[model samples]
Target chain A: MGAEVKQTILNRLIGGIDAMSPRLRLAAKYIVDNQSAFGIDPIRTSADKAGVSANTFVRLADRLGFDGFDDLREPFRVSLLERYDGSAGEAWLDDLSHAGAFAADHARTLRNEMDIVKQSLRLLTPHKAEAAAALLTEARNAYVTATRSSYALAYYFHYVARMSLPHVHLIPRHMGSPVDEMVSVEPSDVLMAITFPPYSADTIDALRLARRSGMKVILLSDSELIAPAIQADLFLKVSVQSHHSFSCYAGAMAVLDSLLHHIVTRGGKAAELRISRYQSLREDFGAYWRAKLPRLRRE
Target chain B: MGAEVKQTILNRLIGGIDAMSPRLRLAAKYIVDNQSAFGIDPIRTSADKAGVSANTFVRLADRLGFDGFDDLREPFRVSLLERYDGSAGEAWLDDLSHAGAFAADHARTLRNEMDIVKQSLRLLTPHKAEAAAALLTEARNAYVTATRSSYALAYYFHYVARMSLPHVHLIPRHMGSPVDEMVSVEPSDVLMAITFPPYSADTIDALRLARRSGMKVILLSDSELIAPAIQADLFLKVSVQSHHSFSCYAGAMAVLDSLLHHIVTRGGKAAELRISRYQSLREDFGAYWRAKLPRLRRE
Candidate 1:
């Protein structure tokens, strides 16, 4: 009764929504979108949140041929509880009817990405990754170099690792050259560089400078042959397979994330501990908003 | 003889490098880092790139007891050719004796990320993803919002899609509230949001605003139940599994990349066409460098 009756009433409201006046239509939209909210919040609260008068909902209820607002709300209240209690979601998960041709292509895109991640992970090779992580960890300073398309991966890696490892830094900081950042680097420092073909000449230059400075080089790249140029001490291969003829960053993304995870693990300092300070500041500064108003009651 | 003599020469130079004068050590460092360059470039060119006089090479050759600089270069030149022709690189790649326990753990990190990508891709459901991409592609404007950890994913997605789709924008533009960026949005717009556990309240606020504005909502989250609150027209689940208890972003990275690929595919626009203009500007602005100094000639 909970599923059937509420769905029927929902269909009736949805079925006749466009024919209704704008006011009733808005009310119907609110009810449909906020069924769980409506089941919990007082109708006045719901009406206020919906930006419509309480009489609008009553009118929508009248239009739907419900006796009144409470008559309209009762079924949804029972349905919301039933939704909370049900295993029916499993059925929805099992339904995989391919809607169209585009869907089939979309599916292939995901499969390709998964395959790339798997293949790339195999290339990372645990021993090499540990040695790579060790170079960064043992260094007096670890300068990360990447540009253009690979910048996001470097940022993600640097942002996470920089939290616990104070010595790690992203080079070419804020539109400056890697030379500017590497200027003060000691011979014992490490350079972790990310690049893929058509590799940026700037990245190669940075790798060269790191070598000249006697810094250990750890490279994440799409090709093994790239190592021939800079002689990267530890090479992490990022497989960038794509039929789209563009850089697919899934491998780089996974490899960098895994490396950062290793950095955090080796540091023995959980990010939560270092991050709580900034988290509290964000809260204090009101950088976050509260969406507590429209929530369904747990009880 | 080329490989063996080159190896002995390299080992001797590396072993006795520290005992040399600062100028001589710099030359050795240059030779070590640019092995192929030393093998291919004119000695004068190598000397200039190494920032040393040609006398430095001749004197270094005298120190190594070679007949001259070219005599020293001959072995490296032959060795470089051998490197290009040999199948020996496979042995180096296969030399994965785990240095310690950390290597084993690092391997697991990669394996875990690969699994997360696989698990999350299955959750995307091809038809649902195609519909999601269509919603974004067809929308008047697609507003992407995420805070904290998920911002990087939104940035990567928005950065890629906004190149081709001018209507796609990241909300809370440069420290503004999502409401401020979303204020001008019409009912035909779409709100794309990313969040994981302990989700940001502001993301939910933006979703609410999008709903109130009668815009379609598409959410990428760690849970499907998230759609129940916002009534997201489409939901793409991101799996954030990690043993260390911090958010793992591989799935989000892969899914968002795949979704953007779908959007580009549906739009029939490759990113390169639009990106070429900025790429040209970068070249004009001298934002790149030349690593052309170091090279192994193709011949």
Candidate 2:
């Protein structure tokens, strides 16, 4: 609910006599005006300060659609309690203050990430995950590239996907002669590009060139503006905000982990069968394996 | 405190009590044992279930040196509220049960990460960060190599460090010719290697070769087991454990952030002078230059 709507409801409940009994309405008005007093003083004292009887406060609970005053006021009490400031770590109070600020920023970052997840969920087609999975399963060669902050996520996906897929390449960090390796990106291959703000010029250039080269593109970016949504076959935009000037990866990590889990879970049975067959085949070719098997030679 | 210490304290508090307080002591014990139930149910109902009077509960609170029963019970209530169940997503009541658990886990994760940061602070000598800053400030080249899960951290550090020191190079992802790169690594150059389990063999190899080449190494790994501590000039271990089997980078991320903060904060007047110079240089070479430049006619 928006703050405006909640405030309107609160005002009506306090102001409208039809909405509440006379004495109960007065108590509501008192609470609305003296919100800070609730944190510093007890409920009984606050009630006395408001010139309302305890019975009237009980009636106020009924008017607010609560079982009792305890029910009506518990949330407020809890919020106030959370806002309590009891200083500790006396030697490093400045550090403690920064830590407190960081905590608040971290919460905001989580909430922002949650919002991004919800936005992506709303905009993304239902077939996106399945289609992406199909490409992951069918691709001949997969190339994963992420510059700057997004590099790790791409690297992990590449590493894990390589366990099942045939040929996988991670993009080079340098723009030197290693750039020639990317010339092999064909139509059958899938190119995953991960980049976030401030985006690397080289990564964006590489991704653009790869897309022009006709490889299927999957892009993960921090903001939708930089996501390359139109050119990419699949796009996921993850916004991570940090309390400090940097970015938070809590949501990004969660999403990546979930994707890995889903992929592995979906292919588990088939993967197990493939592994079993592969093991049998390995044993069949025991002589060839044994020539290079240092551990097995010791046994 | 250990559970044994807590149990001893409880016994000490109830030691002198004889006939009438025995029931109150039992009620206190019941409160501790059935905390989750108390969080979900009302106080009066909890008293009934424990076969104790409300007065006895109040007396137990008094015996514990609390102002009231509410004060004694609130922490247990909050704790019970925080315990989350994995399967709670399927049902509303189950979700409510799980919400508490999720909150508790979140708090625990924060605590664990902070503990790691404190440990890192203690383990890391003042000379370490200072030496690192000095080397980085003076180095002709700095290469950061982190593969798989540790990639994000490396990239983040690299990006931030590049703002002040532009000679930083992130290692190429594919292990195509790390030897070629290592050939260029000099005694004055710094190589930062970051890896976590299941350890990336490629990163370990890169670090081993870098060490052999006499390049200064800064190592970040999950545990001492994955990559031996001797490979790096400065080796930091950040162990992260979650309820989930796969290790999370919460601890590593926290420590890295703290390290970055400490470097910037403790680098003192020289660092401050360098930062201000960099800022002024950035301003001079910033976006305003496009507007300030003379426009050329298209041929």
The TM-scores that each candidate's chain B achieves against the reference are: 0.61, 0.55
Report the C-alpha lDDT of model 2 over B1-299, residue by residue, as the tens digit: 11222334346545644543568767866755654454444568778988987788778778777898676656544333222111112232222223465333333333333333333333334445455655666677888787545676777777566654667777754456344566677888888777764456567677778778788877777533233323367767654443332455544654455455444544456555665565454334322322354532123
Model 1, residue pairs in steric clash: none
Q: For every candidate, how close is chain A to the native chain A in TM-score?
A: 0.64, 0.50
lDDT of 1 by residue, B246-283 (tens): 67888888888788787767666455566555454554
Best by DockQ: 1
User: What lDDT is reached at residue B146 by model 2?
Assistant: 75
- Model no. 1, DockQ: 0.11
**Cα error, candidate 1, residue B245 (Å):** 2.7
lDDT of 1 by residue, A1-299 (tens): 87788879776766666577655655675666455556655677777766667788888788778888888888876665454334222232233335457655665677678778877877777766678778888899988888766776787788777877888898777686677677777789999888865566677778888888888888888765553457788888877877563567887888877877777777775555775555545544332212232322121
lDDT of each: 0.71, 0.53
In candidate 2, what are the lDDT values of residues A162-239, reduced to their tens digit?
A: 545546677864454224568767788887777654455555666667677788877766644452423677876654
Fraction of true interface contacts that also occur in model 1: 0.28
User: Which residue pairs does candidate 2 place in steric collision?
Assistant: B81-B100, B82-B100, B82-B101, B83-B100, B83-B101, B84-B98, B84-B100, B84-B101, B85-B98
